[model samples]
Every structure is written in C-alpha cells, then in structure tokens.
Target: MDATDGRLEAATVRARVATRENIARMNRSERAASALWPVPLAFGLAAILVARVTAVIDSRDALGIRGEFLIRDPDTALQLASVVASGMLVFLGIVFSTTLVAIQLAGSQYSPRAVRIFLRLRLTKVALGVFVATFVFAVAVLGEIRTKSGSDFTPTASLTVLVLLMVATVVTFLVFASGTARLLRIQYLVERIADEARPVFRDAFTRAQEVQADRPAPATATRVCTNRSPGVLDAVDVADLADAAAAAEGWIDVVAPVGGYVATGAPLAVVHGGGGGGGGDDRDGDQDVAIRRCFLLSNERTMLEDPAFGLRQLVDVAIRGLSPAVNDPTTAVQVIDRITDLLGGIADRPDPPEWYVDAAGTARVRMRGDTFDDLLRLGYVEIIRYGAGAPQVVRRLHAAFGSLSALGDARHHASIAAMGALLDAAVADAMPAPFSDLSGHPDPRGLG
Candidate 1:
C-alpha cells in the first residue's frame, strides 16, 4: 500500500484494539451497559420490521381485532416503532463512533484532518438520514393533524413543535460541522509545516560589526593555531591570507584562539574597514581587518562528512602550499602536516570503547590501565594523537617541547629532520598524496 493508506489503516487498527481493551477494563456497571447496547438495537430493528408488516395488513383491514380486545391502529403503531428503532440505532452509533475517535486521537500519527474528515463524512450521512426522516415525519404529522373549518386549516401546536425540533437539529449539525472543519484545518497546518521561530546567525555578526564601528578603535591580537578542515579550497585560501598577514605584518587579524578549533575555508580574521584592508596600510587598519576575519572564520562549517579532520589537519592544509620564496621554508611545516594526518588516521581507526574529556577538555582516548602511560613514555601520544613526532628517547617530550606554539619555535633541526622523514613514510602509507611532493609554486601576493 501507499504511505498514506498504510498509515491510515495502521492507525485505525490501533485505535480499534485500544478501544476494545479500554472497554474490557470498564467497571461492572459500564460493562453491563455496554452489553445491553446490542440487545436493544436488535430488538428495536425486529420491532420496527414487525410493526411495518402489521401496519400494511391492518391498513388493508386484512387483520380483524377480536371482540373484548383493544383495537390498535397499525399506522400509529408503525410510526412509534420506527422512531424508537431509529433513535436506538443513532444513539449506539454516536457512542461507538465517539469512542473510536477518542482512541485515534490518543495514538501516534494522530492526524486531526484524518479524524475530522472521517467524522464529517459520517456526520453528513447522519444529517441526510435525519433530514429525510424529519421530512417524512413532518408530512405525516401535517396530514394527521390537519382540520378543515369552512375551507381554512391551521397547523396544530404539536406540529409547530415538531418543526422547531427539526430546525434545532439542523442548526446544531451546521454549527458542529463548521467548528470541526476550522479546528481540523488549523491542526493540519501545525502538524505538517509550521516554521520554528529562531534568530538568524547573520544578525550576530552584524551586531558585532556595529559595535566595532561605534568604537574609534578595537583591541586586536593575532595568534595562529591549528586549522580544522583541510578539504575545502576556500579554507586553504583563508589560511594563506592569515599566514601572509602574520609573516609580513608580525600579526594577523584573526588567529585560532588557544585551544580553539578552526574549520575549513573559514576566514582567519575580520578586517574592520571595507571587505579587506589596503596594502601597505597602517597597523590599526591591518589589525582591525585581521581580527575581524578571525571572528568571521570562527564559525567554520561543521564537517558532517568527515568527523576525523580536526584542528591539526586543518592547519596542515592551510600551510600546505607555504612559500618556497621565503628565506627559511620550515620543513617542520610539511613534516608536522603529514605526521598529523598519519597519527590522526591511526588514532581514529581503533575504537576507544570508552573515552573521557581531560581537565583541559581535550578528548583523551582511554587505554586499559598503564598502556597510555607507556605510550606517552614512548612519545606515542605526540606521534599518534597530536602528530608531533618528536624523538621518543627525549623523556617528557611534551615538557621539553612545551606548547605547540613553543614546539614550532624550537631550534632543533636534527629532530625536525628526523620527524619529517618518518612522517613522509607514514603519511605515504596513510594518505593517497605524499607531503614532500605537495610543494608547488604558490601564487604571488598570497593568493594561494
């Protein structure tokens, strides 16, 4: 079946079962009442049928009443029997239908439109039946009550009362249907496609810009941290901009805050004036743009596709096409990038089973007992986790190396070269692309 049909059938079946269960749980009085319902309905129908047949026979004068017995007119008897039977049927239908509706409303996938439509269709059928019955009864009443006084006749009070009852029933039906229709329409809209109210992200940036604009000068600082996404071209470009700004001007507008993560293609800083500050500009203008770019880039696009590409790989990609034109092209840059990728792969490959956030809030993968300590002593944490790849013999390489920032600044060419060679082989094994071969002529004017 189609989705809509499947849903409707499932819902109806669920409602029916639940209603039956509820009936089973009812009190003794309720159970007795429920049991009595069908008996009256069946009796009513049988009485109606017998009365109809008796009426025809008596109206034709085929059945004669014996002497000493009350002579009952068949027409009157038939009318009364029909009304009783119909009323009983209507009452039972309403009770059962109402219970069913209530059950459907309680279940999951309770579409008010579906409920309303069903109710409306059934109610409409009932209205038609009531209308026809009322018309027939009105005609019969008029015929039976009519009296001629010199060719003029007036409706009896009873006839007037019957007409009023019909009007009231019609009015009630119309009012109920209208209210239900409106309610269902509202419920349908709410269930299907209501928009959630929330603030737009752009407003926050606009407000920040407004605040900066109001001030004569805004405090700015540039600190480079790891980049988070290495895949997107835009992120690499932004990183290139930040690096050039930092190298040329001794600072960048935006840099990774310590312990903060950078996403791919996100701008490193927010320049205050215009889209970008002018070349050969003063420190104030450059710093403003750089700092603003930093904020702008802070909200890196979340990598839903690749959760493993974190801050370190992002920095590597940004610095991937670093200038061969510079005096000291840090091999450490290439080495660190490749090593980070390799170690990140290894760390990500094995499931930790259970891990915890350290005091610094960095996620530390758990090991069974002192395996983690042994790995640290072997400099495996730096190699496998951070991809630092410093010498294993140097106990407490972390303390000796200091922070990533300090480690980047260390004057040890021997360890750096060794790390670079080892990282090259590891990276080759892990990645499709080799890091040493990644070098190419970068675009002039920091375009790369």
Candidate 2:
C-alpha cells in the first residue's frame, strides 16, 4: 500500500510538471526564474550526465592522450573530486543563506514586493545552477573512481571540466553579488519597477476612441463563476476572449479587474446572448472552459501586460518612505521622478481602444484599464496625502502635475488639474503657511 501511494505521488508530480495549465502564466520566461530548484536541478543532471559520457571516452585506449594527463593515481583523483564536491556544496549553502538575509533586509527597508526583483534575476539563478552543476559533476566523477574498475580508471578530462566549472562558479558568484547589491538600493529598485512599465504605458497609449461603455448584465445574463483555483486576476487574454465571444455570437464583460483579488466561486465574467446552439457548447463545459482559460490568475499580479502594477509598486515605496518610522523624504522624491517620467511618456500616447469588437463592428468584449486619471490617482494619491507635511514631496507633486498638464493631450488636463488641486489643498492644510505657498510652485527638484 505504501509503495502504491508513493508511485501515485510520483506520477502526480510528473503530471503537474509536464502540464502547463496547472499554473497560470507558466508560459512567461520570468516566471521560471522565481523557482529556485528547476534550473539548478536541470544543470546538476546535465553536468553529471556529461561527466559520465566523457568517462567512457577517457577509458578508451584509442584516445592515446587520455591517461597521460592529470593525476594517474585513482585514490588522489577520488580525493580531489570529493574535496571539490564537498566544498561546492558548502559554498552553495553559504551563498543562499547570505542571499536570504539580503532579501529579508531589503523587504523590510523597502516594499515587500521588492523581493521579487532578487528572485527574478536570471543571473543569480544561472550562477546558482552552475554551482550546483559543479558540485554534482564532481560527486559523480568521484563515484566513478570508487565503483568502476577500482584503482584502474582515472577520467582526467572529467576532472579538468569540474575544475573549470568551479572557477566559473567563483566568477559567477562575484557577478551575482555585485548585481544583488545594486538591486537592493532604493533608487535601482524603484527605477527598475518604473522601467518595466515605460514601454507598456507608451505602447498602450492611444487617442481616446469611441468607447462603448459596459451595459448592465441582465438578470438573464449567464454568469461565469470561477472554478476552485482562486487568486489575483493577473491577466486576461482580451483577444482570445473577444474571439470566443464573437464565435459564440455573444458578449463578455470581464467584471473582475486585472490585479484585483478573485475568490473561488466568484464571478469571473458575465456572458450575454449565446449558447443555445453556439459558443463551443457542441461539447459539455466547452464555453465555460474557454472562458476560464482566457483568465490567468495567480497568487500575485504580474506586469506581463498590466502597466498599473508598475505604478502600484512605486507608490508603495513612496508611501513607505513617507511613513514616520522610515521618514526618508528623499526616497519619496526619487520615486516621484520616476512617476513623472513614466506618466509623461504615457501622456504622449493616444487612448487605447476601449471596446474589443468583431468583424461586424459588434462589441464582443468589455474590460477596464487604467486611464491617465486612474494612473495618476494610483501613482500620486497616497504620495500627496502622505507627503503633504513634507514640502519636498508637495513641491515634487506640483512639478509632476505641471509637467503632465504641459506634456499630455488636452483630454488629460482635467485629471492632471484635479490632482494638482489635491496637492495644493494637501500642502496648504499640512504645511506651514510660507512653505505651503512655496511648495505650490512647480519645481522638478522638489526643493528648487
């Protein structure tokens, strides 16, 4: 019974690993970097396998130059391999422990989401993978010396490769450390988050088109509720949903906003007009399955296509910097610089298409996105409210709003103006009279 259960567990693990659908957003390459084991595990297996194959060549008498290199004695060769393997294992333990300490300190000092920056670094992952591979290869080589034709075989080529891997791992560790140190700094952390969304905001920018606002879902509308896997609505494939609805001769409104929390059995979307004989219902559960597949939910939101997440993280850092305990207004000021540039770039873009339509010009899908006002609010609301007491923060907000009003289309002026009013009021109410008056003037330097 125990053996059967173990086999079943093993089979389940394999199936989960092989199936992409089990985890949403697995198609994204960045997602792979977050997992610590997979890369290192693959490297370890490949390294050992390469060493084993090379051993076969080393054993061949036809290769006249094989045994004429490195240690000829099996015991000395085994000892060297053992030492390298053990040393590498110890080295990996120390490196990861130090990394966790860094991550912990960064999270406490900055925002919690800052930890993802470290985990998502492929450089660190690759370096760790090389370390693991070096260790595994050495160990595997050591085993060959002990078990295979004892005292007779010494795979010199395999040992040389192991030594090379060790040297490479050492170099990789230095690079990883330097990169990690840079990422830990507040300026780098916020800028990176801001940079990830620059292209998103720029590319998605567009002139406001004829947006067909969402109509209320009728009582008769078919509600599409989520199945067991509950998480944040990270992303929705708008094109696919539009296509599915068009095919079904129906309309879909994804009620839950991307980046919002979704509970199990909660409404994922509402469908109107379809499925008596349409919308993939030729088979049971087809329409629902199609609808569910278009949504990629996970424990947290990703910036894959969501530009607002960038604003979200930046605002978080700025707000934390404003907190009394971490009252580092300079960090808040730096954050505003990024917010201004990001919003400025977005201000130049035309409005995105609000409605996803089919060939016949019918509205097939309705979903919400952050407008300039929305982005402005998400990026600045808290900063203004919290930073009001600080003249530097208030001054920066004044400048940011002024820049946006100047750089963006006339349509964005109203929103920018409203935010400016809020900033004006916040400073007037929070700061001393003279400082409040001075802070109102646009100063990109926040103090200047």
Best model per TM-score: 2
- The per-model lDDT (C-alpha) reads 0.31, 0.75
Q: Which residue pairs show collisions in model 2?
A: 206-350, 206-351, 207-350, 207-351
Q: Give the TM-score of candidate 2.
A: 0.84
* Residue 271 shift from truth in candidate 1, angstroms: 78
Q: List, residue by residue over 35-88, the lDDT tens digit for candidate 1.
A: 423443443354344444544443453544312122123344335434633553
Residue lDDT tens for model 2, 1-448: 1245345222111000001132354436546767777888899889978987878777774456666766777788888888998888887987798679877976888888777777776777787889899888898888677435644777777776877887898898888888878887889888888878887786456443343333323335464645447888777776677777877667787788877888877778877767642233234366777778888877777776578888888888899999999999989999999999998987865555545655444567767677777888999999989999998888778888888988998988888899888887888788999877777777788785
Ten residues in sequence with the least summed lDDT for candidate 1:
11-20
Task: Give one clash count per candidate, in the order shown.
Answer: 18, 4
